[model samples]
Target: MTRITRRLALGAAAATLAAPALRAQGTAIRIIVPFAPGGSTDAVARLVAPGLTQRLGAPVVVENRSGAAGAIGTDAVAKARPDGLTWLLTFDSHATLAALLPQLPFNPDRDLDPVMLIGGAPYVLACKPDKPFRSITDVVDAARARPDAVSFGSTGNGTIGHLTMVLLQGRTNTRITHLPYRSGGLAVNDTVAGHTDMMIGSAAVVHPHARSGTLRTFAQFGPQRLPALSDLPTVAEAGLAGLEAEAWWGVFAPHGTPQDAVSRMNAALKESLNEERVRATMQEVQQARLVASSPGELATFLAREVAKWGEVVRANNIRAD
Candidate 1:
């Protein structure tokens, strides 16, 4: 054969060999949301699933496998075949589960490959509108004066909301009672009903009441205050500098997944995040910002979160079991 003909023949053979791998990458994608449907994490997963399907040219499905503060489904994805077919859509809890529930079936860092940091939003601390607490300063003052008289409700024990309070207590050298609820909505409800003195959670969970005048927002726990709530002060701005605590979500796949598959999914996710509908749903409905970060960036972020929260968990002796 001529030199050109030989080169063409070799290229065709290589293409044939790569055909199976390409097909595998196109297989239906299963996204595992480690929380119940209708929550923010599920919202993010469902919001992006259709766009992912369009971009990757394969059906995308989001399955809720809720339990153990998202450890069950996360473990399932961690143990899944690393063919990139299965992925985990999890919230900030993914990084702290190891510290909270030491009995987790899988090591989040070791068993899963970071795909992307989808997005994050800071939690807000709110109180009953009629309560005397008007700001973070008032809350801290009252808590310090009355000790455990200022009770706070959290989504649950060992959750970000709860830990943020613990961190606050350590920072201000104050005492506050912690009331753990099964869900953030319920926690917010109790606070609004005057059953709890205060509650801290995402805007979706706690801000609506503030807007409605049912609950009063005392402070937001983020690096900077959100423009929508620009009048409100951040926890740092209020008094506690360096006390920013943002709840973040991210996607992960089983370790050993092919880099090609990871890259394809990552690209699809980035595109989906940029979709107008997806962005609107996250911003308006779920109250989260879109953070489409690379796999390496996500890995670094997760490590930092794990270390930061792990210290709080250890110091406070927080545990799920």
Candidate 2:
């Protein structure tokens, strides 16, 4: 081969090899949901994937890597290559796990870059329909009258339901017996069966039971009352003015991912959230409100959540059981 022809061929080979690196769009983007399929996190990832694919002009897919209370999949994202191709879609437990489990493999705050706050739904404190308690005030009065006698069911220790109850007990200065179950369904069932006096769970989980006359929802934990559950007042309106808790979801990329890539991903996320179909799916199916927040806003929110939940975990001596 002639030297000129050989040089040209080599140049072409180099360009071909470098094409993936030179391109702004990744070959594919995988959203790692740290839970099983059909879970809220997984649903959110799938709901947003199509819009993200359209916006970023690349294939987007969801991968479930559930285990160890989300630590396994979350660690996968934390240790993934910082090429902006892999991200995490997780719930509020992401912030509380670190405090509950002392030996996590990855540092949630330092190992992942915040992408967006996504959104969350208020938790509902409901009781058996036969229970006499009419409001949170009634429940508190009963609890104050009989400390540790009034029991509440929660999904598990260190879960949102459990921790929120911890915060409630702290704020109310009441000592209620807590019965942690293996699943939210079990907790709700127990509450409905009247085995437990009350339970604090997500609106999605308790709303149907409440509608069916199995459970009586007293209040929802949010800054304001939920329109669908208009009869149930807000936690603040129920007399705990400063208490606001919810089951939130967010997106995060591996730390040190390029700023431009992060920005592009965030924009795609915002666009996906604004899409009519995505909004309807999230609200109607997942019962989650959409929050299209900037990366900076997500970072701030994550910091606050981590700190706030961490305090609750420590103060209550909560552990993952």
Candidate 3:
């Protein structure tokens, strides 16, 4: 071939390779929440979607692909085209599931790239108002005294709430029976009805019951006490240090998404998390703490969380069944 013709062919090949990157810049983005609508993951995704849409100049949609302990929707995001148009907004459970479930269709760390950490809320240990326990120590004492008699309810067997209880048992050296329910709402319902001894869940879910005196607040699983629920002490303050578990949510895109798009999304998320309405709504819904983090920070956080929960799951022998 002539040199001029060969050079033209090389230029055409480079442009062809760049075409996908250009197309990705103009596509609408879809944030997939691997759980049912109206949950924390979905709520956070919706809250941030508008801002992202505005920032990226593309329609941002939040889709709920709930089921299989969140594996179903997560797999969907993992298998989606790596063109940066589709993403996943889920909680720490996604990371835990990667470590706990050997059959996960997609490897969270390998198949997905972290975008941003939206925010999180500490799990509150609450009980029926009429229950005898008044503090974390009291609950521990009772669990120690009664063994399997003191049972706690959670969203499901392998959920963060369930694992939080497992960590509690491991730390306190107490045995408390777990009563898994279909959802956090159901678990909270039973806790309020006195059917379950107590429940560990997001502050948003338990705050209303505690305010209404249907459930009594014992302790929160966070680094520090929440502002709205200042009357309640943290697990550490209640004499159990180093026990912090927050229901964290974050955004992730399929691996191989352009770095430019990831950076843009991260910037938008950081801005959205700081918005007054977003903060207020999160507080109103679930008393969640607003934490916007960069992609690298979120990746490190997820890795650490995966390791932390892996130990808890192994020690507790917790499973999906």
Candidate 4:
């Protein structure tokens, strides 16, 4: 082949190879959800994937890598390249993981950079209609009256819901049986089927059943009452000493990822979150409100969460199960 022709072919090949480097939009983006599919974390990632694809002109994929209470997938993202190709969509358990697993491989604070604080939904405690409990006060009274007779179910052993109950028990000097289910659905089903006396879970898990009249929600573990559960009282009003817990969701990138990439991803996330479809799904399916916060804000929120839940875990002697 002629020198000029060979040189032209090589130039074209170089440009093709450099395309992905020059324009990040040319390659696919992978969003790692550190949980199983169908949960709020995975659903939100999948819901926002199309928006990321639209805004960045790149294919966005949501992959569920569930294990070790989300450490496996999260660690994968933490150790990933900072090329903006990998990200983590995690749940509230993220903060507690550090305190629960002292030997955690990656430092959540230093190994991963927050991209966005999607939103949070408060935990709600509910019971079957047949139960004599009418409010948080009634539940407390029942637990006091019969220490181990009043059973409460949660999603898992070390979940925020579980800790919330533990906090309540500690503050109230009550002893209620804790029935940890493998999944929220199972817990909710048992509560509805009268197998369990009561249950604690996120608004996402309990709201629908409450709305459907299968469960009677009494107390919301948040600062204020939710619009949907407006009639329900908050723990503060129940005189629980400001006991509040919310299940939250967020996005993160491997630490040391370029600021430009972080900003770009944050912007795309904001835009996607604003989409009516996304907002509707979050509220209806996940019972989550949209915060759509900046990276700095997310960082601050994450730090507070880690500290708060770490204290809870350590104080209660809770561990991953």
Model 3 lDDT per residue over 1-321, tens place: 999999999999998866644565657788888876655666678887898777677788888877666788889999999777899898768767855677877888799999887778899899888888888889888988889999898766678888888878888899999897655667778888889888888886778778777888888998988888888899888778988888888888999988977887787787776788977788766687777888989988888888888778777666774
Superposed on all Cα atoms, model 4 deviates from the true structure by an RMSD in Å of 5.5
Per-residue lDDT over 222-278 for candidate 1, one digit per residue giving the tens place of the 0 to 100 score: 888876678889988876899888888899999999887899889989888888887
* Winning model by lDDT: 4
Query: RMSD, model 1, all Cα superposed?
Result: 3.5
Cα lDDT tens digits for candidate 2, 1-321: 999999999999998855544563557888998766644566678889999888777789899886656777899999999987888988778888899889988888889998889988888889987888788888889989999999998756777778888888889999999897654567777897899999887776677678778898888888787777877888888678888788888899999998878888888898888888888767765567778788889888888888988888898788876
- TM-scores for the candidates: 0.85, 0.78, 0.83, 0.85
lDDT of 4 by residue, 1-321 (tens): 999999999999999855644686667889998766645566678889999998876899898887666788899999999988999988888888888888999998889998899999999999998988878889889989999999999866667888889989989999999997655667888999999999998887788888889999988998998987889999899888579999888899999998878888898898988899988878877789889999989889988988877898898888766
Error of 3 at 87 (Å): 1.3
- Which lDDT values do the candidates have, in the order given? 0.83, 0.82, 0.81, 0.85
For each of the candidates, the C-alpha root-mean-square deviation to the true structure, in angstroms, is 3.5, 5.9, 5.8, 5.5
Indicate whether candidate 1 or candidate 3 has the larger TM-score: 1
Can you list the residue pairs that collide in candidate 4? Answer: none
Off-target runs (Cα >4 Å) in candidate 1 are 1-28, 192-194, 212-214, 284-287
| Candidate 3 weakest lDDT stretch, 10 residues | 17-26
Runs off by more than 4 Å, candidate 2: 1-28, 36-39, 57-59, 128-133, 141-151, 179-197, 208-215, 284-287
Residue ranges of candidate 4 with Cα displaced over 4 Å: 1-28, 181-183
RMSD of 3: 5.8
